[model samples]
Target: MAELQMLLEEEIPAGRSALLDSFTNLERVAEYCESNYVQSPDKHRALEETKNYTTQSLASVAYLINTLANNVLQMLDIQASHTSLLLFL
Candidate 1:
């Protein structure tokens, strides 16, 4: 568990940095959001308001992962269906 945690911590920072590095607008927003997030409850509302920044950042990453997963599943289903069709033929 500790090893997994350690590995994840390292990987997450790299991934976060990569995500942040992707966009100029998002980077600025994320920087402000991050800074505000640490300050106090007052700034927390800003983070809430900047939903697009956070959502876009995550969506870019999540979309690709989801798309790849969906593609793989679809390919597997097609292959299975093809096999069945071959058997019928």
Candidate 2:
């Protein structure tokens, strides 16, 4: 839901806190999936809830991927800088 996303966006900070929050969000989705697969009082409501949870899960994954990409780029830049120095010798 929009509200859940808003809460997630506002409360969770970047870095370790964000990563832990993302894991918690993923756990919520997994728990929901486990419950919904059996039976539910309102199928539509459960489906909608699961959809929202899935969105949060995807956001977490995207954030992790972006973090990794940034680190990799930084490492490559450092390596390139060193290479240019080495070439001078």
Measured over all alpha carbons after superposition, the RMSD of each candidate to the real structure, in angstroms, is 11.8, 10.4
Per-candidate TM-scores read 0.38, 0.63
**lDDT scores for all predictions?**
0.63, 0.68
After superposition, the stretches of candidate 1 with alpha carbons farther than 4 Å from their true spots are: 1-54
Best by TM-score: 2
Clashes of 1: 0
lDDT value, residue 20 of candidate 2: 70
TM-score for candidate 1: 0.38
Instruction: Extract clashing residue pairs from model 2.
Output: none
Model 2: per-residue Cα lDDT over 64-85, one tens digit each = 7677556556556666777898
Candidate 2 Cα lDDT to native: 0.68
Best by lDDT: 2
